[model samples]
Target: MLGLRILVHSIKLVVRNWRVALRISSPLIAVLLVFGVFMRGSIAGVATLGPDEGVSWLAIGVYLIAQTFSGTWVAVAWHRYVLQEDDSGAIIPSFMGRRVGAYFMQGVLIAIIVGIVTVVAAAALFFAFSGLNSLVLAIVLPLVIALVGLWLFYRVSPALPAVAIEEALSIGDAWRATRPYSGSILVLVIAMAAASGVFGALVELTVESSTYLYLVLVMVQTWISMMVGISVLTTIYGVVVENRDF
Candidate 1:
């Protein structure tokens, strides 16, 4: 199947670029691990039941977007730095720190913009569905919004690396370079998201009876989910670097 092929190729690419992949992903993993420790209680609270649960989930969604943007920026910079070991002797961080910094700032800006967009979109949807049955809209709206948001995210996903490695600030350039394999990249993202969702659900199901178990499970699941996302990004970046000279 096509999915199998994607998986196999993704694995191969990761292996081929193991050094670069790990170099990029290791620091990111550490950062996310620390971040999760700090944010676990808050994120877990988002999953609990109440009239405010929907709002809490939406907030968690926005937080996810922010973390994704931050991590993606750093991932790109680290990958670039590793790939440049041949010619520049790993001078990506040294020579391109300013560009990386700019992209980091841009990532923050993108996170804020995404947060605002999510909030506005949620508000509009909430109002629009005011007359609809809560049960139906609850299921439908979240999926619809998540899919749309992910698509939009995929559109600008490569911008960080474009800025970090290529020194290009314009998102337009990133889109162009990423265009050739957008479909594949999006597939990977969706698969990773679905897998993480399933894993989280399983964890929640297993830990439902005990608060301590729930907290532990949630923290572990969150870390694994994030690691998987970063791993996929690392694989994609490796492919990109191999195919293009960047």
Candidate 2:
């Protein structure tokens, strides 16, 4: 089956790219380590909001926006520089500013769309859960949610490479071209996400007030996020390149 083939091919590509990512990420890893060591005490002391606790909505909005922008930058760098396609080597950093800006904007756009979908999905889930005694609704609601989530991802997954290569500003066009490849893309994304989760848990486990532990946690989390972002962009690019119809 096509899905099976995609899965196998993606795994192979991921394996091949793993070493390249490690090499590309070395400088970033070192910087994070140094920064973490210096900032550990302050960062560790900063309290995070607990679940279900109310916080400033404005602050929350700003935080989410920043996260989205950062995620986009990571995605862009992975595709544009890390993989390098047929290029002799990674692109020069002096000219990479434009690429980074474009990717950041794409990330912001995708984040907004994802946010809207998330809100709608949450509201729907709440209503569905409340009315789940109705078998028809129970059976239908989950399918609807899954489809919406899938469609949202399909719309966003290809934007990284599109933005990197063509510098596309139109997210809609990217979505259209990426549709046929959505299923495989999603599988690859989920696999990378799982890998990210494992790395995150490792960081969480070492969290403590001690400066050493705090530094370790921050350094680990940052590079892991970068790795996940890189894996995602590379996987999506490989999927589209290897399977034109995908």
Candidate 3:
């Protein structure tokens, strides 16, 4: 019930603060547009990368780096807007230097932990079912690993919001904060994914099959999805960790 309320509240918050949301999300949307343009060219030329593929690879790498930086900045800005109750600022703040670095490091650490869990689970499954048919093992192992990864991701997701708020939180703290709401968290994740999937499907069914149109729709969907995600996470952190009302 609380999870449902949180999700509803998130949507309401976005609707009520659409202007602020747009400001916070503009940089990310811009970055997505640039990324889509470059990626389209890269994908179109991928088949012809016979001799001089260095420039293409470099462009891809640069896009990845820019995307990462922009993503982190947007996240931090949203966090600030939510936690600090500040609604008047540039879309991207001018002085998120150390904060960005800290958030990036926290992200890296979380990824490492999730990766370790995945590898360990895979190893355990392999050894525990050595006698099983190879085909069964091959099919089941990946599914099991994916499930475990999703669970792990939900477990630590609150940490990102905590990092955004400069909450002096550790992974263990986040894990503990969300432990009681694990089931709610799982439901929230599924609900969000299903909503996004359905929206994307609708867009695909209705829109003409133009690459540029697809990219534009994707970028718009991504921005809205990200804003909702940020709102959800911030709300969850407030309710669970801070014991406050949304």
Pick the winner on TM-score between candidates 1 and 2: 2
lDDT to native, each model:
0.55, 0.55, 0.74
Winner by lDDT: 3
Write one digit per residue (lDDT tens) for candidate 1, span 1-246: 333344455455456755654444554445444434555544456445422322356656655665565455445555454445422334122334566566677667666666677778878987888889888688988876776566455545556555556644355554565667767656665675677678767878854486556766766565444444444443444455345321
1-246 per-residue lDDT for model 2 (tens digits): 444454445455445766655544554554454434543333233223321123344544444454445444445555655345533344222235677687776666787887788778868686758756677566666555655664576556667676676654366766666678667556654555566568666666665545477556755566555565555555555555434433
Number of the predicted model whose TM-score against the real structure is largest: 3
Compute each candidate's TM-score over C-alphas: 0.58, 0.63, 0.79
Error of 3 at 3 (Å): 3.4
Residue 223, candidate 3: alpha-carbon lDDT:
72
Worst 10 residues of 1 by lDDT: 86-95
Per-residue lDDT of 1-246 in model 3, one digit per residue for the tens? 766788888888789988888878777777776766755643222222321233377665665577678778877887778878855677555547778889889889998999998999999989999899989888877766876776677677778877777787788888898889888876776567678769878656534566567656666676777788778877887778888885
Candidate 3: Cα lDDT at 116: 97
Q: After superposition, how far is residue 140 of candidate 3 from its true place, in Å?
A: 6.8
Find the 10 residues in a row with the least total lDDT in model 2: 44-53
